[model samples]
Target: MKKILSILCFLICVNAFSQILSSNLEKKTLALGEVNHFIIKIDNLNNQQVSAAAKNELLPFHFEEIKDSIGTQPNLYERKIDFSVYEEGKFTIPELEFKVGDKVLKTIPYEIEVINTAQKGDQINDIMNNKEVKLEPKDYWELYKWYVLAALSVIALIVVIFMIVKWGRNKKSSPVVATNQTLKELDSLKKKKYIEEGNYRSFYVELLDISRKFITKQYNVPADVLLTDDLVQLMKTNNTISRDNEKIVEDVFLRGDLVKFAKTFPDKEIMEKDFTDIREFVKRSSNDLEFENLRKDV
Candidate 1:
């Protein structure tokens, strides 16, 4: 009795895992150049990474975009594929086969038809000229084939040369006012909507990256890769920042680190203070550097 009961349980478990493959077509008939949507569904299976892999014969038809698969239930997934054939005729969608965990699943063959709407001396509804000309038998690319290829090659070469010259000129330019650019970047960041939407983490990350870049450029320090404490120490030892300014930097870094590393959501008011602190530090540092440069010239 026990052996018979175990066999029945195994059969029931296998039946529960059965897979169903199906397809949904948005339209059976379409105009040439128009697209048709196919939504494929696989039911009663655990998550296997699913993507639209239709057979090679289905080509000549352009497959639309491969969308991210959506799981509606524990074992239900839907994938969408859009395809269009340029030719006008009845064509059957070959069986779409998908391999799922040592098993193969496929949908039944389906058919679609393409029809041209022009009837009885009507103009071809294409966006081109209304007048219809008699079809001419000719090698389409014979006239401009070499000319088109040559023009494209020349255009590509010119773009490459221009970019090289621009990079050379910038490499030889005078030293940039790093703090001014950093301040501008911060102002632009402030205008973004991250904080308004409660994305405090992103706001903190952008703020920290700008500060690191500024420190690297201005003081010639590797602050971009340094931890907060190390960066502050380097700044103080080099006298890059003033005594009062050190406290401001420390506060900003502490708050930013809390948000980024500790996942602490800071209040908007406190974040506003950090913003003001950074702006003040940049302004003072810029003024001090400019004054020193003038004194040296004298």
Candidate 2:
């Protein structure tokens, strides 16, 4: 009996504290207009980090917290939240999320039970004021027909202007020096917040665009419209890019296709490697272009 009891206790303790965070309410059942406390304790904080205002989305309840309280120890974290109910029967306390690096931890949904405390005499006024009325749908087509037409006309004009502007741009030739523009765009890409926000597809698309545009402008070939396999074959046929540079561009294009069309999200390490490959590919391809320039100058 003692051994069995010890094992059960150990299991209970392990189950209780194994999670990254735990939340509990001081009193789940409270009278309306009464305040109670809710607390959250986080463990293993030394091994992970979380957003500073992690609980912002879970709160601003029916009534605000009495005090904003937070405390931390060497490897432990706790936040005390006091909230009051105004009018409620059963309400769900929103779920909370804690982001540790790239992973998000979510707590189970919590519900609060609030019992109305107002007496019959206090509710008499509310009962007297209660009334029901039918909601009849009205036809607003006649009232706003001209207004809708005017709004749509404005939208059509804007779209026509946008298309005209786009067409003008397409007819103009780019005059940017390939090497300088490629490096400039790469620096601009690094400053973008897409990778930080997990927008892998957008980042990859822009990276690949710079690559294909550079190839097209420098080689005077239409590289952007070709499929990845076809582009690789064309490069090999024309000796446009070295075997190593061809691999780098092909790999980036394949990865970008997967991310943009397949909706596959790559982790941070894969994204960082792709960024490095893009830089190297641009540099090597630029060197090839420079060699062609030197040959012509000769």
The number of the candidate with the highest lDDT is 2
Model 2, 108: alpha-carbon shift in Å? 29
RMSD of each: 16.8, 13.2
Residues 36-133, model 2: lDDT tens digits: 88888888666555543333324634645666587877577777877887776788765565555566665566777889876767643454766786
Please tell me which predicted candidate would have the highest TM-score against the true structure. Answer: 2
Clash count, predicted structure 2: 0
What TM-score does candidate 2 reach?
0.40
For model 1, residues 1-298, the per-residue Cα lDDT tens digits are 9999999999888877787778788998988767778777888868664433323223333433333344455687777656666777887776665556556777777788888866778765667767855644455566677988999999999998899887745442222567678889988988996666555667878988888787677656798899999988887787755677677877888788766532245657777777788888877775656654776799
Per-model C-alpha lDDT, please? 0.70, 0.73
Worst 10 residues of 2 by lDDT: 51-60
Off by over 4 Å in 2: 1-176, 290-298
